[model samples]
Target: MQITVKLFATFREGRFKQADRDYPIGTTVANVVDDLAIVPSEIGMIFVKGRAAEMDYVLKENDALALFPLLGGG
Candidate 1:
């Protein structure tokens, strides 16, 4: 299956803002995160096809996944 990943905030640092990634069937959001070298702790929110999604959420072909990093500010 092919998924489109969008990165936000620090998540985009050194990485692309968006990308098209291919994965085997039954792949989950966590798999893509790991493949991108993004630690789970760094993730604040995840959206799959514009809806809030869990890390374990299964990815479907052509799914649009967005990742947001934990934000810190005074």
Candidate 2:
């Protein structure tokens, strides 16, 4: 299936801000992250279809996913 990924802030600095990728059926968020080399340090928040999603979340065709870099606000 194909999915859209959006990167934010520093995540976009070192990675793809938007992309369309293909994966086998039943692929999970973590699976895609790994495939795209999206390390934990590059992921601040993750959203799937406008909602927060866990790493184990499964990705569907045409899903709009966003990954933001973690901000340190003290």
Give me the candidate number with maximum lDDT: 1
For model 2, residues 1-74, the per-residue Cα lDDT tens digits are 99998877766666777998888889888887888777865677889999999888999989988877676776
lDDT of 1 by residue, 1-74 (tens): 88999999989899999999899999999999999999999899999988999999999999999999877679
TM-score computed on alpha carbons, candidate 1: 0.92
Listed in order, each prediction's TM-score against the native is 0.92, 0.83
How far out, in Å, is residue 21 in model 2?
Answer: 0.9
- Residue 24 in model 1: shift from native, Å? 0.7
Count of clashing residue pairs in every prediction: 0, 0
